[model samples]
Target: MATEYLSEKHLRGFDKYKYNAKDTSPLSIYVMHPFWNSVVKIFPDWFAPNLMTFLGFLILVLSFILLSLADWSYYASSRTYPQHPPVSNLVFLIIGVGLFVAHTLDGIDGKQARRTNSSSPLGELFDHGSDSVISCLLPIGVYSIFGRDEKDYGANILLLYLIVCVISATFYISHWEKYLTGVMFLPWAYDFSQLALVVIYIITSIFGYEIWKGTYAFGFEFRYLFVLTTMGGSVVLSLPNTIWNIYVSYRDGTGKNRSFFHAVEPAIPAVLLFVVASLWAFLSPTDILQLEPRIFCLTVGIIMSNICCHLIISQMTETRAKCFNWLLVPLMIVATLSVSTNLGSLELYLLYCLAAVALILHFHYACSVVVQLADHFNIYVFSLEKRSPKAARVSNGTK
Candidate 1:
């Protein structure tokens, strides 16, 4: 399989690459490391790292499905009359727990790999790829939990769009930094953000969705405040660090071609995704908030995941960075339809199906790059084998 992905020459070329992990989060150093290390100590030696990665992803997918169903129920019930159906507290609790477990499993996979002497670049790529998928889903789950209101359609869609963009941008910036510096740095926000999201889920479970819809201080609803703070604060905390890192890299001669485009190119996909989504919302016959909102959210998630996958592949293959142009086709189709004819329900459904297909191809491309890299490294995706005696000796000598 690996041979099908990469040639012998490319394999030799990748052998020179080394990965560096630089995490400076206090929460990670003090809390997560200790907790994860303890968990790693108890993990069975036979556990496969890739399996753990897949498990986490599967759990998140289950959570997504559950939440989508719950959201659909609310939408269906509301369509008959005016009020949203009361969602069971258990639904929220279960979803929250699922997300928490997914996050834990995600963290544990790396430690499991290192403990079992199975660490490889493929493992790292797999982890990030899974994370990229989850990042998009997380916001969608949050949005679904807060049932949509007809009155707030404009604000709701706009906020959701902004949240998605921010999440994608932050993720892109992190990888862009790695592309420039060779070191992957984890900030404090990265450590706590997942926990914060987990807490939000739990809180929603306990208080119910209505609690978030209620007014909070500053004449804002609790959900809006939460979204604003979380998304805005993340941008505030992360954007500066990204800029400083780029500046430092340029000053030290580590990064060449210090240009604005270099700093902003990685973010272009997210920006384009936002634009596409916005155009869809503007052009659609029905309000985005009134349509199957979960589907729209899912579409955004898939597009964002596609972008993340593109960035990862570009970095892995040492190719020039570029946004996924194929994403624009759906947008263009919708745009043309809006001008030429009103999009009926069937047309809209077909457009969504097209977007879904695009997502599948995007993900496939990401997986292909990973497989090629794994072949180059002579590592199996699901298993780690001991190096040859001579190879081991060479590694030890290098150390």
Candidate 2:
């Protein structure tokens, strides 16, 4: 039966396959769009799509830095979990608003490009690349808001890490689907999840961080239950959906069995990073959270960023997904250090610095790929004007 379906779809030609964008969120359609469309209209003719992408990323980075500083201070004071966050309520408010605005700008960049007649694959790469970084940062910020203690070895800590992994996996799979079927699937959960983060910030701002630390009707910690449910839902809902999508694509011949490596290759770095971190956490004498809570977050953020970078590069170059092998160096170093001896504060600091360097290098690769693709396509990264209209025409035809 599978062979018959594949044969029929092959005869039909994969070029006939259309990319589908699915979004069922009423909040996004009824509430967000009305407002977002209005804001897009106000964007001046000269406002470049890539600029909006970069600006949104800048705002998210600022929020992450503030949150990290606050978290480090709280950890340094030897504060226990379930306490109020050390940051001011005003900061939470600002972070919430900033994230929302970032989301807004990200959503409209394509429209801005279309309006300015400057749409290119580079615009898509920039938008997704920024999103990849923001995805890691946003969850880390939320974890800090919950005042999660990384020092403790418990189910809750494991769940927290699992939640981060699940988020990254969903993102990875989404891009994998794009690689396979050439369609970007926007699940309803994606938008709602972002809104939920925004709501968390608002709640922290109004009722104070103590609210998140409190128990709910079921006598479970609210944050614990939230993370548990997120992990559970991904396993229950998302995992199955992803499998079904792959199956359908194969049946439709939009995806080829010979290209399975293309779908799985981008995930190799992420998997390796996760395994190395897990080994380090288990083997080290000192708890990773105890070493430096912020460092753990940074490690996770960098791994996710590496994964995102690989996805963007693969898309831009139209090649099989490749891992950022340089990232493995720090992970291997940390893993080796874990069982060798107890790492002092100085050693931890050095590790943090190394991770930061890895992050910078990963982003450099992403940026370089975008520049090369832009130059090849003859489109300006920050302008509506094409560098070579004839080249652009030729590229469009090839695409």
Candidate 3:
């Protein structure tokens, strides 16, 4: 079948594709997986795993939408903003339930695929590709609980930006490691973080967001603890482990075994993302993030997801990863314009435009890649059914 976004090399590599990974997280292994095993049983075999993945994605979208309705400027729960009303407890409760259900569905899609013998590289693409986007949404949703009021316990834009960057980077690192080592080492923080966020949402729902409006005994805010723990876990545990595993792969002569330059090549797009995002937020003439954080965050998420989806295609098909992504070109342009010109009130409009462009590009990439894969595999994306082969036309254009 003809393809776009995937080259002939990628198409060829899919014939030999196999998923190899290890999930050694105690929470994932002992708790969530078993829980998911039970959960997947509740789904009839006719239900497709990709449907579960998409449903989970939609649930998160709903959560984001609900929060956006209440806290469009992210001042909903701000102690500093006396005029801004608090987010509805009902909304938080709904978000909590949505997050839990989405997390559960995310956990079970693979097992469901196996149960129905519907597993394919497309599953990985859909699942993890969706996850790259989910990685950003989860943080932005959680940000709604505390918000961007730096005067109080809420995190400032830069700190929240840092938290978001850390989350997306850690996720990309997992796949980048796989790109280099040819095995996926699932992160331990995922299950634990989701559960913890659920707890946070529940606590916020019950006790009100005022509960976190205080400093810890050590004089630091409780909000900083999230950043600390997140960075601490990655630095002390995951980062070191990833480095060691890649080192072992190279030393033991078992990995892709490319030179140092090539080994780190896949990270270029992400680095550019971090640099441009930081400059845009930090140097915006209009303080774009404060004006509209959700748009900025979602734009980053969408672009990051696009980069990640490309990496996923490369990893799944065992083809070469891109050194740069075209999605970043417009991003760089927006960042440059935001910084170089005194756009004033117009800068916010520019950000909205950037977000629109990002969404369009990401959506096009997603649809094109999924359709290409489905056509090449002679299978449906959100269904277990196979497609009838396309009728061939000869010189006369006759089937």
Candidate 4:
């Protein structure tokens, strides 16, 4: 039926806005419309299949709900029941699984959209946008279980990093849109990063050491060389894949702001500070027990992750017009400076406010950017459908 409807003769005669037809291409190929045709064909008369964009949003929403419920500190139970450390590991494992599951669902909506020829800007926006929330929220949810408070200035920093992710993603997408002919959006790799982090957490929960440090012959204390190495390596490993995605997105024709220099942007000073601080920790034996490696890892991860977030948000064409985003670095600076100022209560209050403000702004910007991106994609898809004879006919029939 779709073939007949999209046939050249019919397309030549058809009014673009007045008719709708199906594009009977293998429904499997489109990421956004997974199972739509099969579902529709199985019960064409009884049920309407939602577009992949809708499904992706739905899954994202559900994932957030699940994360909200999964306490990161469920591992505390292990502390109480020493004999059953496995319980804590199990709890953490479950949370990790939930995260992975959410990540998995992340791709389905895109797949579904493609299969049904129902791809839209909203779908693209929603699919990518939810990531900002998930990225920050996942860490927060996990950290909260680790005894961190939302009020912990660090948590707020994580949220700030989340904003960066949104910025970076936007930057990546928009910049690429400028140069690339089509979206080279490797939705899989992006999703895989989240999955790998979950695996990292699982490793942490199962073994206190970050690496599989075996006992040295006749040594009283277990050597932790492997753990430190892995943790360091994981951080490094994460950086390239992330940068690759950003590079691909920036160079791709789909994004609009294409500058070679900008593509190789510098690490934010804050990130450099983190690297310095981390290197300092590793180099100075005095800082080891005082600044726990795990805590250091988490902090550095939070900072670096946010850097990615910033790059993601930068991908968006419509974001950061407001002056407030510019304040993020200064605010982070202020918070860091407070530790040195010795202003006691004043420092604490100011840091608190900075974190609170950053979190609110980050989420606000992310949500807004994602929505706008979605709208733009929707318009683009609709325009393409209206302009393309085959697409026009298919769209009309669908309506």
| Clash counts for all predictions | 0, 0, 0, 66
* Per-model lDDT: 0.67, 0.67, 0.84, 0.39
Best by TM-score: 3
- Candidate 2: give the clashing pairs: none
Q: Order the candidates by lDDT, highest first — what do you get? A: 3, 1, 2, 4
User: How does residue 389 of candidate 4 score in lDDT?
Assistant: 35
lDDT tens per residue, model 1, 1-399: 212433343344345445676777778888988888787677688788988898889988888788777666334212333465555678778877887777778878988987888877678778888888787777766676554454432135556666866786688778887767656776557667788777877886788655555566878866567687768767877778877876788788775343676656776767777776777666667564346555666676676777776666556545556745577567566655754566667655766686677677767766776666654455566766654534322121131
* Candidate 2 TM-score over all chains jointly: 0.82
TM-score of each: 0.84, 0.82, 0.94, 0.48
Tens digits of per-residue lDDT, candidate 4, 1-399, equal 211212232222221212111222232246334533344343222121133334444554554445444432323222333332323455556666665545445545444455456554344444555454444444334433332222211122233233333433333333233222223323233433454567766785677322322345555222133223323333443445445655565566434454555433433433453445434333443333132322333333334334444443333322221112243464446545544445545544454455455555555554554333323223332222333333322332332
Per-residue lDDT of model 3, residues 234-286, tens digit only: 56657887898899999998888978887777898999998998888888888
Candidate 2 residue 125 C-alpha distance from true site, Å: 0.7
Clash total of candidate 2: 0
In terms of lDDT, the best-performing candidate is 3
Score residue 213 of candidate 4 by CA lDDT.
Answer: 29
Winner by TM-score between candidate 3 and candidate 1: 3
